[model samples]
Target: GESVGLHLPTLSVQEGDNSIINCAYSNSASDYFIWYKQESGKGPQFIIDIRSNMDKRQGQRVTVLLNKTVKHLSLQIAATQPGDSAVYFCAERPGNMLTFGGGTRLMVKP
Candidate 1:
């Protein structure tokens, strides 16, 4: 089974800091990986994505690094802000379906 789950659901960070969220995946063959940020009551929005062929990908203020050797993945947020506080989840396309990670909640402190 190819599933992604977070080690923690809630993370607290100062208004102007950096945050790192971790995720564990169950499949090494999953070719497509995506990081999504979900606010309070909305659907997950795409932040960044990486393919099996690559080990790293970056976006505006986000970076996704994948380690297929251990089937592990991580997301790093630079300059964490209040608006950057949200739930982050990872999804992988294993077969025809997308398996999503449990999700990590981030809290920004001022």
Candidate 2:
């Protein structure tokens, strides 16, 4: 049995536009955070990650921001594309286990 969690559910964006996905975590002791993108029928793929010591980090076309003060995390995608359409999830690593958010579905309208 899994505990209840928070999630956004879905998000829609226009192609070529930027997309912002937000997440909230409960563990104040979490030190590592990761963002993943999951396509239909596929496993969650790594997007970007940030540490509790850092406020922000960036990847190829993605950026992850962590606000430990508010226990919040956010991901920003540049030039949203149809190929980018997927479910995005945030994970917090507390100790040796990882807890994941419900996820946000990103739809890119072409």
Candidate 3:
């Protein structure tokens, strides 16, 4: 079976603050998880990744927390800015295939 969908997106926050988004997955065998950010009319850019063997990983101004038991992941962005406003996606890379979740839009109030 195939898995993918589209949904409305909206996130508004004050500038220089932080933001967090959540995701849920159905596949338990998935091993790798990645967070990506995409701007208007662009492809998803890699932000960070975490393996199923671990529970947490952090990157510049970003952190990813994974819960293997629940099949969930989350991304935290520090110092949200106007330039940071964009759509964020979470992808699960199992084997040679990459499965993407519907993105969430982030808005930074200036």
Error of 2 at 62 (Å): 0.6
TM-score of candidate 2 to 2 decimals? 0.93
Per-candidate RMSD, Å: 1.1, 2.0, 2.1
lDDT of 2 by residue, 72-94 (tens): 89999999989999999888888
Task: Name the weakest run of 10 consecutive residues (lDDT summed) in model 2.
Answer: 1-10
lDDT of each: 0.89, 0.87, 0.83
TM-score of each: 0.94, 0.93, 0.90
Q: What clash count goes with each model? A: 1, 0, 0
For residues 1-110, could you state the per-residue lDDT of candidate 3 as single tens digits? 44422243677889999988888877777889888899999988899999999899989999999988877788889998788899988888767998888888898999
lDDT at 36 for candidate 3? 89
Candidate 3 or 2, higher lDDT: 2
Find the 10 residues in a row with the least total lDDT in model 3.
1-10
Clashing pairs in 1: 9-105
Per TM-score, the best of the predicted structures is: 1
Best by lDDT: 1
